[model samples]
Target chain A: MVKASMSGAVSSMLNCRASSLVLVLVLAALGGCGGASVSVPGLFPVPLVDRIPLPMGLHLDESLTGYVHAEELEEQGEWEIDLGSAQTQMFQNLLSGMFDSVYPVANPAEPGGEVAGVLVPNISEVQFSTPLQTRSDYFEVWVRYRFQLYGRDGELLGEWPLTAYGKADEDNYGMQSREPALQAAAVAACRDAMAFFTVQFRTIPEVRQWLLTEAGGPSR
Target chain B: MIRWHQQALATGCLLNLMLAGGCVTSTVQQVRESATGMNETESVVVLSRKTRPSQEETEADFVNCISKSMRGGKQRVNVVGEQAFRDALFPWFEPRTAPVNASDLPELISQPELAERLASLGLRYLIWIEGDTDRTDSSGSLTCSVTATGAGCFGFLTWEMDSGYEAQVWDVRSGNLAGRVSSEAVGTSYMPAVVVPLPFIAPVRSSACSSLAQQLKSFVLNEG
Candidate 1:
């Protein structure tokens, strides 16, 4: 980048002085180092369709879930934002993170060993809201997460709600930046939600049995 | 004769400057349009536009792109990832939920609000980068018996855009404009290697606005 800068200077001097091979040599030294779309798949213009009605209130229809869909929770009398399709992506990212947190569990059990029970939590609703909007300028995210549980047999274990949120208020300055906190809060919310499942599933009888009998490990 | 020579030279230089400026500016304008691969769509001509002052140009670029094309078919702008940014760049410190300085960041982009409002009216997903996209001016005057060198010279108001993007994915069905995500980049521009080069940087620079308009020509046409 500076090469251009020096060149601009040298060129001007050369035209003025009429002679300087020596400086020209130094000029080349500058040029030396320095420096320097997504085609959505299977995408096309299709007839516009809106409002995907979830049949069982458990799983949303795939077709209508393509875009970010939102549904306010009338039950809790609160506004919950479900990215719908986007949540699937968020869930995948969370699983990858959990694997990183507890590395071994993330790994596929073993070659052909017996399989143990699995727990999959379906996050039905999530939201960042306020009891009432406040003007206290700080990085505070009031997050509420709602999820349903499924057992390995693909049977409905129990669908309950769990909540864990964070409140961090610090100015984004010199070293630490604000964006990271906002991002971490979101990811942490997802992770904590996973952790809650881990804690709960560990208490289940079938899960406990599977862990001890199959994986050679068990806890009361 | 010397005076005449100087005058002639000055006139030639002026003309060249304007001519070169036109070429450079037009090339800049073509930047955004190159991404969309469109031209002809009336949306292209309208959206690829800008107002004066370079400071807000980046913001203007995004606003123009989204607002101009907002009406027709649903639109989406891809922003860089958030975690990738924090991990790669700001390893030492990152603000937690407790301490976010509001003054540094714009109070509200009004984009999401506008997008949400539109969702209720029947629009699709409305996307935006989270806070920190806007650059922050870091230079200022601090008087002292100091080295004085590099001191008090920070005059220009500016901001360096770090990383992050947020988009409100709306469900027009339930009429809930809920889904929101913000992402950031490790460096200024997104990784072109991971993905194709962005048609152009969002929120075109003010000085380069006209050129951005020219680029939109191709993008609008491609949309067809």
Candidate 2:
């Protein structure tokens, strides 16, 4: 009877090993197939700034209004980020707060005579890095923006590029998943872009000169 | 039936086992650079230092813990939410633009608009927390396996954790360094497995957060 019991215990141990292997295989399969798609929130705080006493026109092309980034990494499945209307709305709030008045222009080539000058904003590049890629505890995002200035007569005056960065710590989020952390980082990058532009807009030499002329009178 | 002495011996063994598993120690210290007090209308905010990129920042949950803890209890005072305060004073309190020292407050509040905003919030103090919890040491290992009928584990594991945090209270209204409080905690957690793994986790970080919050509350209240 003792020998029989020993044989039974050995069989049980083997069965346990097989079951554990199956469980691990199932979890690995699920984890390997899971990918994330995140839609960033458009909400931004209206900055407190002394508004310039000049009416301006803002031209937002479809690229800035409806932007989406999609990529696939080896063995990491696929990722998609839909930033639709977030950038457009952010710029709308920023410009309105910065200038006395801002009106949308249909075409930048022929901006009407109602505005002092026309401002055109474009997204030059967007890049992101995951914790797995950087071997860090944070997910980071970077956005590059270029602002073009046009006189009321539709002449390109100057173009300036600004780069903004944001990061979110993985430990701060629940479940420590990729979607929420990535979305938070993306929102932070947008906020950083807005803040940098608001602070540095008047500091640009060309924009400063244009502001002086436009505010002083409609000479430019 | 089991004898009375057997029952007593079993109870004693259980108590000893519990005592062996529960091992967490903590310490708190403070320095008063200036006197501090708060009225009923005045409030405070706890913010983690995020300006330094090379240093490990205090966890968000720890800040939240301090805020939440000080908001309740008998000695509880008014506490402003960190995110709301940052959002309301955007661009100014941001990581890139925030003032590093109390001396910068004169220039910071020089703007009439910012001063007015500060007045509106009745914000009296700004507490900046810095530090993090880390796994100091770890040893042993535990292995588990599962079968269709049940699961079992066999091994032993133990790990040591250490938490350290410091809070610098800045009186925004006066633009003076009010005081500083620091907390430290160390603990060892263990998991020993026979047929099933039994885990005994020591609350290292939680203990540090509690001690820091309590000291901060009293420090702001100017109480012993």
By DockQ, the best candidate is 2
B1-224, model 1: which lDDT tens digit per residue? 99999999977954553443322111221112112221122111111111111112123234344334333344422222233322321211122211122222222223343234333333222222222233322222111111224211111111123333233332222333333323333211110111111111222133233232222222333432
Please, what are the lDDT tens digits per residue for candidate 2 over residues B1-224? 46988989877965665576567899999999998999998899999877627337688899999999999889888999998888777767766677888878887887776788888888999999999887787666545555567656666666677899999999988898898899999987665557655566677888998899999999999996
Q: List runs of model 2 lying over 4 Å from the truth.
A: A1-33, A216-220, B1-17, B147-149
Q: Write the per-residue lDDT of candidate 2 for residues A1-220, one digit (tens) a residue.
A: 0011111111111212333533443343356565578988778877766678888899998998888888887777798877656877888888887788999998877998889888899888888888778877677888899999998889888999998877887777844368898898788788788878877888888887787777863221
Clashes of 2: 0
Q: In candidate 1, residue A198 scores what lDDT? A: 37
Off by over 4 Å in 1: A1-82, A93-118, A130-132, A139-152, A158-160, A166-188, A195-206, A209-220, B1-224
Model 2 Cα shift for residue B58 (angstroms): 1.9
What fraction of correct interface contacts does each candidate retain?
0.00, 0.10
